[model samples]
Target: MSTVLIVAEHLNGRLNAATARCVSAAAALSPAAIDIVVLAADAATIAAQAAQIAGVRKVLAVANPANAHAIAQVQAPQVAALAGGYSHVFGPSTTFGKDLMPAVAALLGVDQVSDLMAVEGSHSFKRPIYAGNAIITVEMPAGSQVVATVRTASWPEAAAGGSATVEAASVDATLPSHTRFIGLASASSDRPDLQSARRVVSGGRGVGSEDNFKIIYHLADRLGAAVGASRAAVDAGYVPSDLQVGQTGKIIAPELYIAVGISGAIQHLTGIKDAGTIVAINKDGDAPIFEIADIGLVGDLFQVLPELEQALG
Candidate 1:
């Protein structure tokens, strides 16, 4: 009889793949009703996308001009307003959820369960701590609302082809004016999104310079993978910070992850620990990344990359 509501993540007018993964995580709680809340200026378009996520029973769209930017300050209160009648409220453990869910938990007067990796039961769950080094089991207080962030990396995206109902959800809360949407700036790439890409190719300080990083991109494009970078590479001005992958940057779990010239810092390894098949190519055979890599090739990237591109072609 428990009901769960997921806060959908979207951009422009489309749902994020993470939202479907949240639905897949919610479906593990059999017999529980799963619903999604879409908060946007034009929610109908996104709501329709959410409704198509299998395992969802309903989609609630809260359309408002203030919602166009997805500022956590503005959306937290709205999420809290919609938390009623639901025993649990969930969001993806991305930057969006990390910023917003804690506030929702505070408003609900409950401790938030972050990075939920497994649903042991409705109230019992498992999550990671110490940079995913340890997983601990937690139990939500009985009779209290459970607010959690689903770690999209640990679960699979929910399949499409659902026929859930989409309805307009009311938000009667006062809007906060202090938090305003300013102009936004970010790197644009035609390559797959780093976080959701099934295959990824990353570079590090070994890439030498920004121009040399093109070798990494060429290999990535040949493999149809996204481009990623180590913090060192980003700090060295070899790539944009958005491409950095490490404990401090974006965490991803692609099926095939290729590390070219990356020395495999522990911080960097944390980000890709969940990746399915890790292939490390470094000049140093003693590099720590080789210890966990399914395939390790010790060689000079500049020489090896061209050969790979030709072979793949």
Candidate 2:
């Protein structure tokens, strides 16, 4: 019977939603047992959350002061140590997993499968390549372990209400001293997190300036959607780089994605290709965003945005 282990991602004592999506991908492998490994300074809270994800057989909690910062050097060893006898080890395809999973694979002496989107078999899977323009299928080496990062946007989150047993893991790996936690410089916002939000509203360079971007936010607020921006908007200093959405930024698969003033560069389109429904608004009728939009509106965004906000209000 195949068993799978998912490296749970958490921050500030809260579990990330990506962990549940990783669990969904693991379930696709038809594993006989699925377990989650939680690493943090105080893992009890996150462990309690992990125990609630459906279909999880067990939760392995590793509470350590060194694991607080999510330093890959410390996390990878703990994950690798707990990976024994498991057929597959999974992590989410987020900034956290991107930085950490390869290290785990290296420690286990195996190749890491990047961005696993579909499970063809227990040992085979499909993933994207060339900035998501091409998809490739791969089969893991037989009898060797499969270490993969699940493309979280491609999988629905596993349902809650699981009754998994949580236990502390016994690990004796030497912690790395080369890394230390400093501080996080992040913008605090009441808006939903772009990667996990169900609806997203993005502004592009046509918004003119950072001040003008408020209109986009107004519309987003009315819709109760997460605010995002194109690379141009970010590069032009209208928004922080964290809010940028493109091939070089965050990939999202929201149920509704609305683009205002975006010309829809290929890089930008790559980020929203998985969206359930796309709505594009721009004066340029030929803007590339309209090409893929489920609903296209060619008009002045300056006037349209205010009107749209009022209508929603």
Worst 10 residues of 1 by lDDT: 23-32
Which regions of candidate 2 are displaced past 4 Å?
Answer: none
| TM-score, model 2 to reference | 0.97
* Tens digit per residue, CA lDDT, model 2, 153-221: 999999999989999876878778887788888889888889999999999999999999999898888
lDDT of 1 at 263: 90
Kindly report the root-mean-square deviation of model 1 from the true structure over all alpha carbons.
1.3
For model 1, residues 212-272, the per-residue Cα lDDT tens digits are: 9999988888888999999999999999889989788888989999998899888898899
What TM-score fits each model? 0.96, 0.97
What lDDT does candidate 2 reach at residue 289?
A: 96
**lDDT (C-alpha, whole model) for all candidates:** 0.90, 0.92
Model 1 steric clash total: 0
lDDT of 1: 0.90
Query: What lDDT is obtained when candidate 2 is compared to the true structure?
Result: 0.92
